[model samples]
Target: MGAAMAAEAEYGRGERATPENWMYRPANGWTYDQVKELVLPFDWDLVDGNIVVRGMAVWWHNRVRNRLYYQLESARRRPYAVDSEQCIVIDDHNAPKPDVVVFDETGLDIRTVVQIPADKAVLAVEVVSTGSRLEDRFSKPALYAGAGIDYYWRVERDEDDLPVVHEFWLHHEAGRYVPSPEQPTHTGKMTTNVPFPVDIDLHSLIDG
Candidate 1:
């Protein structure tokens, strides 16, 4: 909580902590290495210079992420890897971590801060939480698209607490995401061919 508060203070400073300071300022370095020390002691993200504390999610959220991870993992071929809660560096000021990210494995570093470049990412998926609905459905898609990321997916919980998946692809000419046509299904299945062929059984994945 101390690190979280410090990061928030730094963000509040606006122009005080410039990119130049990132090279020399000890506090700036601590914020940059949010995961290195236990100071922050939680999952945090930098969003347009603001520090976002990623608190724990509901059981359904974890279950959905795990289910999607394994599904994507089984479909993963050479040169592609599936990861959850990984940070994608949109720019120096913004790096929003997604729930599940599928990225190219070439030139990947397991050590240090694993900041996957937007271009190297095949897809960024966010399972929407009540606290993150706006960022997940709006801010993140815009940021990811603007960064030239190819694909984006949003998983929303319905009134019945069931997962509903939405998929989008980047339209470079428009510099925005174009939503994929909704799949017609009676059993609450979502299917998409972008990034890779993925068929998600939302009902089974959540209810199981």
Candidate 2:
């Protein structure tokens, strides 16, 4: 048992540490210090749950990450920060770490996870890594939409295929995130026009 779990030992019965049973039980909230300590020793993810780590998922994530770093070097208007695998507190109720998050240049800084406000994100990207593809596809989209995020990208890689980045824009008319009418062409490039026009070569990221 980790120090964080020991400190929050009051959480009875439902106090499972596995993703299958561990849930965001806000009745006994966890502080960032607690979350950090617990994550240190285990190959686990501390979001709303403690997901046991998967090697393949970690592999795919790194593939995309290498390409993103290359692309960031050439970006026209750089984001305040481009953070991968860092938690952003949307509010008291929610905090999720997307695979790639771009913030406003003005508010970017190296601070605690709680300081990275979800609402300040201009773009949130999630790569299908392990459990709950539905969480990345459906659940997170709704959460980001509600948080008023301008852009959300779902990067999915299937067993025998290349990765695909599905674009969703927050449609002002319906106030929901719907797939863009036209799929981006495969110069392997795509761009976001809402927060800023960030040109990206999608093919390069997926190819790796």
TM-score of each candidate structure, all chains considered together? 0.78, 0.69
What TM-score would candidate 1 get against the native? Answer: 0.78
Compared with the true structure, all predictions reach lDDT values of 0.73, 0.61
Query: Clashes in model 2: which pairs?
Result: 80-105
Best by TM-score: 1
Off by over 4 Å in 2: 1-9, 12-56, 76-79, 108-114, 158-160, 181-187, 191-194, 206-208
Tens-place lDDT per residue, model 1, 169-203, is 78899999887655422238866666777777778
Error of 2 at 37 (Å): 5.5
Ten contiguous residues with the weakest lDDT in model 2: 17-26
Q: How do the residues 1-208 of candidate 2 rate in per-residue lDDT, one tens digit apiece?
A: 5644553454433443333223433344543333433433334433443332423457667788656645643563655566676666665435666777777756554553445676678678777766748778787777788778877888776555456678887886676788866553223567655445567866667562
**Ten-residue region with minimum lDDT total, candidate 1:** 20-29
Best by lDDT: 1
Clashing pairs in 1: none
